[model samples]
Target: VNEILDLLYTNLETYPSVRTWVFQKVETVYTLDVRQISGPQFGLCFNASHLHSEKIHEFLYTKLSSKLERDTLALWNLLISLLAPDPSTVTGVRLTKYRKGKRKDNTGTDAVVDYEMDNENLEDGGKILDHEAEIDEMAVHDLGLITVVCQYLCHIASIMAHSTNMRCNALQTAIGFFLEASNAPKTVCELLAHSGMSVSAATTSRMLGPLRSQCEMKLKGLG
Candidate 1:
């Protein structure tokens, strides 16, 4: 299994056939029928149990653990290109030909400047603009990448928790702890738990117990 995963990972970008097959498999898994739980408020909701049987965690550990989190730009680009193969596609907007900026005119008034890329690389010809369109586009791309990464991580964490009672779910655990700190309702915790965004309220209490005890010990010493 590890050998197969390694081969696929190594050849993911090197070979077109491998890339197509891998992406198709990924799409199939993503489209699997999972219980969609909705609440009054609009938020991310997904059933982790549906993905528990899937080998997403195995793929993640074997293929992506080394670099996925560190080099998200590459993942962002890959995802964008895969989802939007054509430059005119919706996701392809991230591939901008020009870097927008600002320059001072003869009258000292700031004018918008578009630094067109000569060959997919930005050249220093004008002062880079820090506001408006460019920043907004960048912000959108960053958020999209973050959302994708976090959701996948959450799925892996939740699956591990279900299959092996694993406590290595730092992302889900953090969300659970945050909910605990916020004194969020048990119903709220349960809702997020179904979505794999957090552990259940009971699990959160168990996880927080040691921390609470340590805090109490420190308070006593200070007192």
Candidate 2:
């Protein structure tokens, strides 16, 4: 399991040709949709656009929550779909995204079935086993949207980019801050400021405060 996960975290593509647009927003609840133009692959075309911090943060906080089951096919599909494209060996690839319905689905989001076979030709019995559960992300026009897989990969990359000592020091810093407000945790403001962030108290209390709690709750639930 560990090896499989590591393969996914490292082999998955960090960037793809897709743009996310905010579709509907009701109060704090947001429904984001993705619009993609798939060509040959990464080397096929060039569409360079920046990602929106606000949107991507929202996606990570909400979608990448603890709901992801490590033992199930959800992680498998996500990692496999995000796997680096190989136009050479891979015969064909199909991506199917399931939309939100009346009741919330597995992983608490839509599922995408990513199909891939390595046969030289599609005629032979080269069908791969079908895995389940998937997700996507949101962004603005002209700018590219980060896929859900890439988003999680980015999180992993951030940790991998740090040295062992750097990671330890960073965790120690986080622990210190976490212990500081272990009891009556404030949403943002002083805590974040003390952590060397430039977030304003008002903004933290009104906006990020809730968002922080949401992400924390999601993590706690996963545990």
Could you say which candidate leads in lDDT?
A: 1
TM-scores of the candidates in the order shown: 0.39, 0.19
Model 1 lDDT per residue over 149-174, tens place: 55564355334433333333434655
Candidate 2 lDDT over residue span 36-70, tens digit each: 01111211111112212243223332233232223
Candidate 1 yields a Cα-based lDDT of: 0.49
For model 1, where is the 10-residue window of minimal lDDT? 33-42
Candidate 2 versus truth, CA RMSD in Å, comes to 21.2
The local lDDT score (0 to 100) that residue 106 gets in candidate 1 is 42
Local error of candidate 2 at residue 215 (angstroms): 14
Clashing pairs in 2: none
**How many Å off is the CA of 81 in candidate 1?**
7.2
Off by over 4 Å in 1: 1-165
